[model samples]
Target: MNGLDEAVAASGSDVISASAGSLRERFEAAFMPNYGVPPLVPVRGEGCHVWDADGRRYLDLIAGIAVSSLGHGHPALVEAVSRQVATLAHTSNLFVNEPEVLLAERLLGLLKAPGRVFLANSGTEANECALKLAIKHGTATGRTYFVAAENGFHGRTLGALSLTGKPSIRDQFGPFPLDVRFVPYGDADALRQAVTEDCAAVFLEPTQGEAGVVPPPAGYFAAAREICDATGALLVLDEIQSAIGRTGHWFAHQHDGITPDVLTLAKGLGGGMPIGACVGFGESGTIFAKGDHGSTFGGNPVSSAAALAVLDTIERDGLLENVRTVGARLAAAVDAVDHPLLARVRGRGLWLAAVLTTDAAAAVQAEAQRAGFLVNAVQPDAVRIAPPLVITAEQADSFVAALPGILTEASA
Candidate 1:
């Protein structure tokens, strides 16, 4: 047998038969230490729950950090992925594909504007494309600086990280190539002061997802739009975590009744299938000419198909209406839970954070796992809950019923 064949033969059986402990041990030995070993080995999933290797079921509240919009094993998502992969999975930018074009059209339609889209494989990649677009626009306009919101997360790639406002993660990568200025989030005055005539773009999230689900003040985006318009800066909204009906809107910026020059989207766009889009409205859309930038798998049929499925499902199932009513109910219920450890809930629609009275988010997360619930410790003092868009009122009620007890146990 060939070398590759022999290697696969040697390890395939072991991998198939390994239990959770054994799998984790192998993972520690074989994989890079970047993420460390994950706590649970999820073997299967259905609806809003996942079964670990030990067959323990847990109600998934975070939905893969807000990626799985339709939840686990969604038939629409599954069928779209299966059909696309089987038909035409990978077509390089050398040729155009139907799903990619349709997705771009659909995204622009949702935005209620004319635009061009550049598809990528993740949020960072989408932001990277935006960065290049901004740079190109800068080069043409003789702009030198960029402005972004403090505590806002754009992405992890070097250029995108430069735009990100979190110091803890951005500082280590140190001295980024771009000249990006940071202003306090939701502070339109500071944003106006920072985004001068020479600024190329202004990057901001409608709601800061990584900063424990913090939404901007009322009319924040309108002020930003005005600032960018007067200063000739491109307003780039990174809706990586808030788009695709997460906040009861196609794009979170829609709530503000303003549109961004450039909008970056991912996460829920693909329903866990890994797709991102960098859409530019009007002139910004056509900034990247013939050979400015490209990704080998950027607009591949499979990912595009998956994205279309997510969009279609969201529309067909009336998930936006569901998000508005159910999300409000869920937030009210969680807020009403009388507990000393709980402070308040932040964010809009299904994206929420249970602020704590103390730094017990980690303990609460752990306790929640033991109680058959999965939540995210987005911060030391915040527990993030961004469940699937398809999560029913009944499923959310289950978590609400168990939360007080979970908090009590965590306090101990």
Candidate 2:
């Protein structure tokens, strides 16, 4: 038997093939319908491109929702994961691990702030950790309310969802445990009004990723810092989709010249491996004493090694500068498309969204896929482009050049 057949037989499963229909059918049967049915079944990837089960190749612009920082099959990530797994694959919080400690130290060093790190498996978990810490701090200070921005997204878990401002998903979840106040995103005055002494924490995304890569207005974050300081509220910046060179800086809040008391990171940190971190600064860091929180697979060696490799590669390749230069070029080229369907572009660095004149972003996304490129319709009128940080000038230009035609096809 061949390798595929051997694996299937060993698992005692029915035969499977690389055909898209078969794989998708199996996927639906074996998995929950939360994400619905995926449009394409990608079988292989390399650099900035991925091949579907049917053997069609396309430029991967979304990069797994901005998680694949160094793109697919990066040698450094592969080597590190392989070496670490071979040496030591996992060590629960019961024992110490080198990669986990190093990863925490490296992240704190990048922030240039004193803090303690809580490792987790996903962005939602990271936010959950932040939420717990905030609540502990608030409870100690006799605060009961939390503040977030409308149209902002944190995560879907109970604690994180409580801070999420998107009504569509949050409302269905019903009354959350935390009392949260919603404010208009990018409105400093509104934020100031919402965040008072009663507020325990203010959760904000430096750039709203799910709201179509929307960036806050200039001076907004700086004003937020002042407000939080005045109110004695903790500022929590969720950079799950914007950190690790997805933006031009190490962290998106840095662009606004402000530092959040608590920060959450994931997505791009592990370069496709599952990992997340919640960092609490100053007194907030001390709220969680021993036995306050823990995780089993949170900081396993494989994922920590992968995160380290991603960080190392980002610095070694100068991907931060690359993101700035190429992102500017892509934004300008997208705006210069001269297509009537094109409205404008939003976001900074590699995280960008093309806002369409009409609510045809889904159609445009489909057309881009047909034309050998992958993009995300983050909203009815916004197509998101968050390619690998290593995407080149030519690669970005190719997408821009094809966008006009794609928009025309989508409009038709």
Which residue pairs show backbone clashes in model 1?
A: none
Query: What local distance difference test score does each model get?
Result: 0.92, 0.92
lDDT of 1 by residue, 267-369 (tens): 9999888888999999999998899999999998999999999999999999999999889999999999999999999889999999999999999999999
Candidate 2 residue-wise lDDT, 30-128, digit = tens: 999998888998866789989887779999999999999999989999899999999999889999999999999999999999998999999999999
| C-alpha lDDT (0 to 100) for residue 279 of candidate 2 | 93
lDDT of 1 at 357: 99
List of clashing residue pairs for candidate 2: none
